[model samples]
Target: MTLPLRILMPLLFWALGLAHAVAAEPSGKVLRVLAWPGYADPEVLQGFSQRTGARVELTVVGSDEAMRQRLLSGRGRDFDVFALNTAELQQYIDQGIARPIELQRVPNTRRQRPRFRELSAIPGLIRRVDGLTQVYGVPYTYSEMGLIYDRRQLSAPPDSLQVLWDPRWRGKVLAYAGGTHNFSLAALALGWQQPFELGERQWAPAVDKLVALRRNVLGFYSLPEESVQLFMRHKVALMYANYGLQQLHLLKAAGVDVGYVIPREGALAWLDCWAISSSTGDPELAHAWINFMLEEPASSLLVSRQGLANTVSDSVASAPQVPLRWLEPVESEERREHYWARIHSGDSPSRVLQR
Candidate 1:
């Protein structure tokens, strides 16, 4: 039974298309990662891909919130693991997007500093099920969000978070555009011991402080390189280092004469860690990836090149009086985000807090 020429040709093409698509499907396993830029170095990914049979596919994001939103967009099925700050990891845990880590599988974590090895001591890393504890994230790197000032512009280092509000720095200051850190910095300047735990009464004042900072600054920056560019172009006298010492490293490498200060109120610090996705098909491979990153060479790249402190470092900046206020999960993430939006829209202080 010979078919007509036109129908036979169409049927043959459809069968061939299906065969080609199936053949093009990848054979090797893949370890998908959602991480920050430096965490996805080309050489690191290539080496990881070569070491393990699994290919490494990394998606780089700019901020914690950006990473969170990306994970939510895919409903945890997109990446096998994530590199996120501890403060932001909670949302993923709460949403069941992240899974508890098996410490037995990641023995390299034992090489971490004493402080990092005690995950249960930390506020957010542990959970209990039937009286057995589980760990969620593995602390990888950290930095303190401090103040960076041009030594040439000022003779002495600014000692207070209030310096950001100082009218003296008007038109000469650069700030991070994010709402979270800015609000926290405002709360710190207002002497709130728990800056993230802002009460309704404290909200108005914090909004007012942030509005002041917004009005006085030349512009807000998002990236470390953007801060360097802003400093060079606008003669930015002072900057809130959102990327912490990483920004300072970039600025210094660019030949900027800037000094970093912790201020009297202390700097807000962040601890970024590796977390596994609950929906991942290969938990052991994900664990292997985390263990690989904990190797000495990875820490060396972080400390020597990126100016970030890793978990295994012995001589990290740990002075007792440095007063570093590690960032925590805030009282109401939604409220802070809502109010901070108004602050950025050039709203008057009174109207910004009206809601």
Candidate 2:
């Protein structure tokens, strides 16, 4: 009852091809993700890939400006989903680069805390687009920029932002190298109530203040690990915790004695959220990525590994009892960067003011 040899051979090849196609189906599908550093750890991405048959390509951004440039490139077709602070999310939504989220597709949102569940309560989460109010982002994690001082070097925690400029601590302080946040911090120290909104008169003064800060600091750092190294190696007496509690955790884990405090001028806080790109090729896959981030492992990693407060759980380490000034759209981001470049490069106050 055996078939002819040629006929048998053709059938065998057809069956092998079918099996290979089935096995490679998942490998063919890919999901591109853009997020902040530590937001998408390798373990978390691997979990998503294991549970679903889709591969994840993750891109980690260190600064808000860098994140914006990446998303804006190629009409935002390069990434499917990205994480950004609520304050910075407005510009993307306005440019039509951000797409509305379909809540039903992301059922894991039910697991979020009540404050996050009410998206409408948040100022920048829901926006009117084409005559319809739509949800654009899902809350993920947050932290406030506070001052971290060495316990052995100081009598107690610094109570104000002015401590960063104290002459006694000159050459013994470490500060963030970012322009936007540093400008705001400088404005606050100068007694300006609206730190983010600098007037024409406030610009030169802020620049001069930052110049003084540059001379005072041991050095400027852009990453949490670098800050830790500088703080430990230089015997840094005080630091502007740009990464907030995350930096504190890193320093403590490194065996350094440090204490964190929110300055009386009010700490700048940021709420980072997950959002979809308007040019995403597969909306369903993007939604899945967002949903997966809310799961236990991904959400818990933000707290345990990154020292951030996740939307799904209560924070174990509470921020100090001080007013938290959530970041708002600055008067001009580009202008801040322009001025800060000169200040950071050791430009003189008068020379920097020439522009």
Candidate 3:
């Protein structure tokens, strides 16, 4: 079946089950979740069910847009918990699809890093309203956008972002095709200060630089899994990637010679958070799932095995290659908005190639 059909079929069945469950006698059980890939491994859910007797069922979402649309469609009422990137959390909160998390119910909330907590507490981060202290989401895993290169091909990894512009490597480099982050990376490589916080004037320079790099790019990938495969097959020598550890592990398992690096210029850091759906009837089950994730064993598994850094303090120490400072809170909203708007305005893939 086609990809869209594959997704829609399961979703339709889920909707039917939800309607039947809601109308029939309420069971005060079954914790449904909408999560990203690898977020709800069978073992993880089994452990939660064993301890709480709340059977956990999960639906995996491919992107932030998919998650938002599912929630907006009122299908979110079927799930007790949802995972979303910090960038898109505010929209869910504003739409009332997600509600403020009840901290007292989640004891493990205290285990999170101070910086993670502070960022989660920031009103505008999860809600557009001003001066609201309501905490709507619990920060889970953190990631950064960086370069993954085949060490066997290039004796040493490129130290600066400018290497992407090198003609010798033309048609051998891969980049994320349709995102502000890639554009921001290009701008940084071209010596634009704080590319993520660009102004209208900076947009032209960033776009010009991206067009130059596009000339050299072998291909553009939208999915992380596909990018990882490209590296393994040697279809591309270098790629802009997220989850450095995860990608490295996959490549190593496939016997691909690869390594990841943060450029001399910093990269963009992103956090994913767990939020309870306002429409959920079983708050306790949702709370249990959140606490289960924050526990040391699970947190460590997430970090060491999945290569994602958990916000909570646990058995998992920071990975050797990832810097702790990059996990710092994002820049102020004003700066982020300016940069986001500037980069997005110049994000036409066709325009990028024309230049």
Superposed on all Cα atoms, the candidates' RMSDs to the truth, in angstroms, are 11.3, 12.2, 6.6
Model 3 poorest 10 in a row by lDDT = 1-10
Could you say which candidate leads in TM-score?
1
- lDDT per prediction? 0.76, 0.80, 0.63
Candidate 1 vs candidate 3, lDDT winner: 1
Candidate 3 Cα misplacement greater than 4 A, ranges:
1-27, 120-132, 190-198, 232-235, 303-305, 313-355
Candidate 1 lDDT over residue span 24-125, tens digit each? 124477888887656545556666666776777766565455666778999889889988877778888999999999989999988998878878766678
Q: Give candidate 2 misplaced runs (Cα > 4 Å).
A: 1-30, 49-55, 59-70, 114-123, 345-348
lDDT of 1: 0.76
Q: Give residue 154's error in model 2 in angstroms.
A: 2.2
Residue 162 of candidate 2: its Cα lDDT?
89
Candidate achieving higher lDDT, 2 or 3: 2
User: Clash pairs of candidate 3?
Assistant: none
Reference-based TM-score of each model: 0.81, 0.79, 0.74
| Model 2 C-alpha lDDT versus the unseen true structure | 0.80
Return whichever of 1 and 2 wins on TM-score. Answer: 1
Rank list by lDDT: 2, 1, 3
